[model samples]
Target chain A: MDVAIKEFILAMVVLDAGKVQGGGCPVFHAENSQEQQKTSLYLARILDGVVHDLENGVLLICRH
Target chain B: MEKYLIAVIAGTVSGFVDRWLMLRSDYRYYPTYPHAYLTHLALGFIAAGLGAVAIPALAKPDYVAVTFLVLAAQQFRDIRNMERETLSNLEKTKLIPRGTDYIEGIARVFEARNYLVILTALLNSAVVYSLGWQYVFLSAPLCFLLSLRLMAGSHIGDIAKIEAGQLHFDGSILKVNDVVIKNVGLPAEREKILREGMGVIIKPIDDNARLTLDAPGQRMAIIHDAVSILGSKVDVGEPHFAPLARKQIDQGYLALFMLANEPDLEYLMEIIKRVPVLESTRGTTLSSLYGRKAAD
Candidate 1:
């Protein structure tokens, strides 16, 4: 696969991972104020996971 | 002015039909899909043209009346559909916001425009009835222009409200709530040759910072306006970083858009990853992230 194409797929795969795992975080659906706050924190964590992978260029593969 | 009137009629009818289709249970959130919105608008325009030509040939008044009735009835039927979905939770791409009551507001505007069109047509047609066919013909087109002007203005207003954070972009903000990275890039020698309003901002990796921000329209302009007024400061991150500010939503969502898409997505992300996410979220930066990369 071309370098760009490979990179594209990897990036897409990572995003899809976040979308699938997002599953409406507990804080995203929390009823109580505290639970809601916690849900927001959890949501942040999920986003962090997604962002970290994207920044590292983890999806890109270059031929050595 | 005549062409403008034609555009008005076309736009009004287009806006109404656009709203009608959008109000459907399966379709309320559809407009956020830029491709889908364009498709629907084309469809609406075709329907109006067909009605204008074919209806006059067939039953004349009844044809036009039925078209209005069908459009109006469809919108009304979708009111209950609105109750089924939590408007705030749904996010449709970057153009429209998720939490705001856009569907309802859009529907209300469409209905108001519909009545305006019908009322104007009726009054004009009635007055023209004693005159000549030319007069009645003129009436239909006239009402259309009025409706179009109103619809365009309303769309512009909706865009403004979104920027003000009076409308959408809430869900994304709630999710990626923190300010992670910031960077500012000055307009290089190349950008000086580019258009009047253009610049860039770069941020680090800990933030896919791009995927989060997309918003309604007018606010996008406000951000553009701010960038133009503040010069390099806009790019450096001065005012946009403000909580729920229009540019805040725009910048974040833009980063998200530039980050998530394929091909060109990498272009923006590369710049964002290299540059530091600046503190103030103001100042003008480089003209184009990837554009410069290609030249290099």
Candidate 2:
């Protein structure tokens, strides 16, 4: 639950729960489409987390 | 003889009339498949029949049949359980889940409905047999409409004032009106809300309203309705652009933010106004305890 990061690592890979697929460095699994959209914005924009989609429900979220 | 027959007819008619008029396919729909309908309908008929026949059975100088009414009560409770189970199963598969409180409320209504059916039937039968069959034309519709009126409960609009709010960001924090929704530190996400974001601020009229709207599950339901009605503009990967209900619990106010396909403020406000008060999240201390204090 504590998603806090410290002494930032260059890149780390995390599995998405919602199964949204993309090229983002760290993809998140959102409960539904609306949630997926919010997660995309938060991780990709604010957190500077890369957000991309793959045909697989997996979305990739990573740090830029 | 013929009087008893008419009593039975009136009772059964009254019960079915309740079912027919009140049964609807809407946002909080009960499964309307033929199987579901037929099952409830059949149970309703038997309940009506039991109520109608109670007079005759008692007239026959047999009191033991009164026990049947108790059995019928038991049966009705089972119907509530059955309803809750089915809806709970269906919730698992839904894109926007109706929360547990909402589901339980629907289930309770389903169960309570059968008892209403029985009450209507019994009252009509008693009137027909005791007064005369002629009274049924007047009594049946009265009972049916009464049941319908009884079924209505609280709506969001009843307790809150809803107005469209502007979506703005200070730095990266998103604000719907004065309420800070979340710290959206992302520039792209902030831009999306400011450009495409539409929102509503719901201010509770009193403490009761505050208590009812405070539940996270209830707020989620409101957000779900807004999104389902307005349609989220963003697609699969856009988590930040999704509809959200951000609440100020102490202040008894909540704000909705969304990047909707059609950004109609009035329409979205109307949709939020109609969301039903969830069953499980039923009562509030505000109406009684807090209400008196606030008035004074």
Model 1: lDDT equals 0.32
Q: What DockQ does model 2 achieve? A: 0.07
CAPRI quality level assigned to candidate 2 from its DockQ score: incorrect
User: Candidate 1 residues B158-267, lDDT tens each?
Assistant: 11111111111222222122322221111121122122222232221112222222333322322322322232221111222221222344334321211111223223
Q: Encode model 2's per-residue lDDT on B15-89: one tens digit a residue.
A: 877776666666544567687778878887877777777775676656888787777668778887888788778
lDDT of 2 at A35: 65
- Superposed Cα deviation of residue B50, candidate 1 (Å): 21
Worst 10 residues of 1 chain A by lDDT: A55-64
lDDT of 2 by residue, A1-64 (tens): 3466542322222344534334323434466655665665555555544444443444445442
Query: Could you estimate the TM-score for every candidate?
Result: 0.31, 0.78
Instruction: For model 1 chain B, give the 10-residue run with minimal summed lDDT.
Output: B159-168
* Regions of model 1 farther than 4 Å from truth: A1-64, B1-97, B154-257, B262-296
